[model samples]
Target: MSNELYIEKNGAIATIVINRPQKKNAFTLAMFKELGALLDELETDKNVKVLVVRGVDETAFSAGADISEFLEVRFSAEKAKKYNDFALESIEKLYRFSKPTIALIQGLAIGGGLELASSCDFRFAAENSKLGITAANIGIVYNLTSTKRLYNLIGLSKTKELLYTAKLISANEGKEIGLIDYVYSSEEIEEKCFEFAKQIIQKSSVAISGMKKVIQSVVDGENEESEAISEIILASYCSDDYKEGIQAFMEKRKPNF
Candidate 1:
């Protein structure tokens, strides 16, 4: 991975930090490729039970794609399509990552930054953070997958309002509109994020991962009891984690997942 992006593992929780703070953590195409690769490795790493994505500093989560490379990577239809495809692959991976994922927005989360956060299972932002998508301002249409994610999240009208205006909303407003799951002061955001992650890590990974897929399937318009969904439910019932959980519950002790 580039020095601008790296992963830190702490027991069951893994964090991918975007470190180009000098550019407000704006991601270059190289960085996006590195991010996509990292997610691939972490996807099957059993040691990781939760994943958190954040900028290295509180200044900004990311200013979106680096405009400096636009002339080189997005100046033509062919080039832009390739560039967007690379970035979206990573975003889609994060969206479908089996583990619980969280995006911690300490500051600005604009354009692609907001899409990154929206892809995660939870979006926690600092009270002072700002977030929005800016495709309208640049005269470019937002891609369908990211647009659909936002539509599923904030609903059609709110998604339309956000995409059309290109206005960054405050973290509180984001939370109020269901764009943000939690918000806190800069001093507390990271600490609170881990606290929540620890809580998640304490749960049954089998159940959590299975439910994550089931939820995503539902969001993607799957029926309540698709064969795949039933398989997930059935597999969970036969998991060692389920057996241990029941035993611990009867024995009045915390179950080790």
Candidate 2:
């Protein structure tokens, strides 16, 4: 797609970089479709087992929906819905991606940026990064999909505090509230986060993907053992990864999976 948003692959790990550093990696309406299409492409790629989403540099992860486009794109209810659908598709895909995703934030992750980071399985932010949702500041209401993701990550009261205040929180504060999974120095964030992604890819992809689905089902209010969930749990026994795991244990070696 556009150079403004592109993917960089390294072995089993692939990263989608938000490249508009000048705009703090702000995403325009068109970039949303490009992002969704990239996710679609990556989903079918056998070689990619982990995805990392980040900005071009350590300045910012993203500023969220480019405010400059709001006049033309979200000036009315119908226009807003059309525009939001593009973003919803991309973020939802990232949320339910078959593989794992990590969002590495450095300077800023506010507005839709914070929401996008919240969608990832893991969020690693630099020590002094600024994060928040500023929809209130612009007189715009945050969409439910984005709101629910934040709510799931940080819970009800904290989510309300964030939305109501429109205040930026520190990385440490984010961790304390469960919004950030890891915090490191700006210099250490990338190295540590990518190392984390590498570690995950070394595990069994089959197990990881299955658990992702099960965990999401639970998040969506599935508490009981449904037949579909049971099937996923049972099907693992027949997967090649399971066979290799058993063989490796017997042979006292690490599994190739």
Candidate 3:
């Protein structure tokens, strides 16, 4: 009912915060709708080259969906399906977002929270954080699309082990299993995540976006159309960024790619 989702802009980066700290940032129906709309706005905002998602407090990224609302709104089979569809739309929007995305995990990323992080291009968590996919414990089933996203990042075996057991794994274990890209001390997580994003922004956005599309196509088992690949290559070659990159190299200067 409140402004559960907050957006903050920092130059080329945008941070989306799940703001209901008292509930461990548990997402409500309104929060899901707000997230979808925010993501839609970001998609057309070319100045935003990177996006970071995080919880307001350091205790939890999101405990899960708002359980209190479930009884009243998602109790029936038909309503549950509709609810799932609405939540899934927001998740999918993040999954296919054009620019690079990072999950700045400060604490527990559980259930739907983990699914949300998995949708991002990269995840960086604090050393003391824990993550798990716990649909089994709640007597609900994870949708096929969410399962595919998790499987693609961590492999089917690891995905199954996490889901079937419904156990929380440490940040270290998450990194070992490829669930998280990097882990940092709680004291340094925010700075570290922004540093990582800055490094990524120094690279060619055109190339980064092209690779994202190719990776998504491969994950979706779509045919790699030669024409599409050719277009990407040609567009990158012709962009002003490409010219600046080459001239900067010849001049021994850092490229503003």
TM-score of 2: 0.98
Instruction: Give the range where candidate 1 is weakest over 10 consecutive residues by summed lDDT.
Output: 215-224
Expressed as tens digits, the lDDT of each residue in 85-144 for candidate 2 is 888988899998999999999899998888889999999999989999999998988888
lDDT per residue, candidate 3, 1-257, as tens digits? Answer: 25788788998899998998899888887788889999999889988889999999798888778888999879999999888889999999999999999999988899889889999999999999989988898798878998888888789899999989999999999999899999999999999999989888878888888888878787778776568876987898899889999999999999886
Full-model lDDT for every candidate: 0.93, 0.93, 0.89
lDDT of 1 by residue, 34-138 (tens): 999999999989999999999999999998999889998899999999999999999999999999999999889998888899999999999999999988888
Over the full model, what C-alpha lDDT does candidate 2 score relative to the true structure?
0.93
Q: State candidate 1's TM-score.
A: 0.98
TM-score of each: 0.98, 0.98, 0.95
Cand. 1 Cα-lDDT: 0.93
